[model samples]
Target: MGNVKKKKIALGLQLLIALFLGGAAGFFLPQFASFYQFLGQAFIRLISMLIIPLVLPLVVVAVAEVLGKNHFQKLLGKTFLYFFAVTTGITALFVFASYYLGFGQGVNIGQEGASLEGIATGVKIDEFFLNFIPSNLFKALTDGALLPILIFAIFLGYGVGQLEQEKKEAFLSGTKIWIAAIYKILDAVILLSPVGVFGFIAKDVATTGVDKLLGLGQFVLGMYLGYGVLALVIFPVIAILYKVNYVKLFKSIGDLVTLAFVSGGSSVVLPPLLKRLKKEGYDEAVTDFVVPLGYSFNLEGAAVYFALATVFLANAYGITFTPQALLFTVLLLSLIGKTAATIPSGAIVVLLAAAPQLGLPVEGVALILSVDFFANAGRTALNVVGQALAVAVLDSKKEKTEKVEKPAKAENVTGKELIANAG
Candidate 1:
């Protein structure tokens, strides 16, 4: 009972403190809003810096571990199959929901709702496939080509797997230590989230007022609600079916989501999220690989946002959506967008690219840019939660397979338990 009360108090403190700091930023620095903007930008930059090195080591370490052990390829094949299926399923769910809920349906918001913008308008599938392979890795970097970065990460992980076992283990172990240290720094960064969340939220609300929210309100509302339902309802149901109850499951990771929200960047939230999933009965191996992989490839919020935003743009421009056209748009985004990696400007770039592909307007992004930062906080929170959930599903399937081979149970206990057990 005392512990429960303590948890409640701690949570309350976080919420109140975040609110206070956010509100205080507005009052204290009334004239210099740019300073607050820098504060948010700096926090996001730190998260961005941390994510790349974070992913490299995790991918390298995880690949070494998975490949050196038993039936690694089979496990990986099955995991990817499930991961892709789940990612697509989540994407499909939102696309359908957007259409069903009829959001941004009647609104006329974008100037060229029907323009192909700068795209070639129509391209052959084979040509697009050919484009996926980077013509120049250097050029891709300068050009912000996300698909190439992802292909590079996969190749690097696989190459790391070809090394000798002992050497690989040493490398993995060293990388693991560095990852742990990075996570510790992540925790310290998270400790600052409440202050950061408040600043961003309060400032966004103050400037936009409620009017902007009302203007593109349908799309904005859809983005948040879709994620909320998926994260709270759909994800929890998926967990329970996997034999993990959603209540404890969601509660287990609540702190991390809240932390991610405050931090305004999901990458900063990744380390703690991976840890929480393990504590909640997911495997470290699966979480390590899937979370990093999912961050790059499977973004639930971005997927939903893309759908709603396109619909909003199309509607705002008085462009009608044919059933066939909407289906094609959903299909392309699920395939291309899901494979895209996590980065600071990824969603923006993708959305800009998407406009021409879907025959929507590019200026739609400019119209939404101000709201992106605000909306993306919620996006990161949900996307990170979804990544953790995906790993939970993968972990469940593994548990099923292991049990079929032999009975299984919590094989060990450590941390505070080991100390108590030692005494």
Candidate 2:
């Protein structure tokens, strides 16, 4: 554990150094931004390649195993409901906030002729629902359509759950093996993140110069503001309802929070977070189940950023969203945000994937990519807090349920004493 922590710290320092070096290169040597651009983009593509393989099997196995066990059914249902409600609610709130508060109003980073007008007029409510049901599964897989793939995986997992035990176990074992292999590949990809971060920052700084920094600053401030609301307001309300001491809860996990903030990734903090929860007397079963699931599904921080960034970029490009368009955008972000756990900086990859579909320019994504490290710090810290809170709440609920169902013990009496009394 000590060695792991040391290594993580070492990597964090490496990334920080890379970020500084990249920015300096971009500012002083704008002519070579193209090289940095290639490095960054290649890293993104490698991460993208692992997403489907990683997400599909992992989701399938998770759903299958959870559904197969009757004991876990209720826990699974509650966890999923909590994750969905919190993520979607936070996403919608930020979507409205970003639009009303004018998050990206004055920051135009050369992305002209891009508009959400077509989306406003063309996206029918029914069509949006239909998009999740792919007519051809093969085509959906080939096209890397996340929504359709996710819907299909859920159904497939459920089907597997209903199978005979032997068959189900066989299938699950096979899928888990595949998932393990993919995770190994994912780890390799993540080791290259510093290089990717450097390239992205250098390229953007060189191409747009310092003029774009103002817009980047605005976006970062907006993100931190949203994170503040979640940390200060939304999560406190949740903790209160669960009978948890919100302040104390955070204090207990402070080390993990710091690690998450510095690392800008949740994967590294997960093991220690789980250990901390267990040490704090949270239900091990609940922590083990919900914390990991929350990483993939309940990324409140990423959800907020997704909604905010989408609207920010739209406004930056001089587009105004109608009510219907805003609603569609919120729904799209809520769904895509679930994919943020597939890799480090996975939010950017998912956003880039959804950009063309959202009618936002690809260049807009690149602009956001340059300063993601700054945004990710706050984002990942909130992610760590959110996951911990979810476990705490669920475990509290489980304790309450167990208490209610527990049978009271009879008063103790010796056999001789009972016989004498009866006589």
Instruction: Indicate which candidate wins on TM-score.
Output: 1
Q: Over the stretch 1-423, how does candidate 2's per-residue lDDT look in tens digits?
A: 556643255555667777788889999999998899898778767766776676677567656776765656688788899999889999899998789888898885664333323222223437667876889999999986766777787788779888999999999888878866876776687677778768867876788645445657888888888889899999999899878888988988876676466556666556456657866767655665677668778898888778888888888888888888888888877876665653446687667756777788767877776677778878888999999999878775656445433422225656664453333
Q: What is the C-alpha lDDT profile of model 1 across 224-290, one tens digit per residue?
A: 8877776778777778877755566667778777766655567767766776776655666667778
Per-residue lDDT value at 299 in model 2: 91
Q: Mark the regions of model 2 whose C-alpha exceeds 4 Å error after superposition.
A: 1-9, 71-76, 91-122, 212-223, 236-299, 302-423
Worst 10 residues of 1 by lDDT: 112-121
Per-candidate total of colliding backbone pairs:
3, 0
Residue 262, candidate 1: C-alpha displacement in angstroms: 4.1
lDDT of 2: 0.74
lDDT of each: 0.65, 0.74
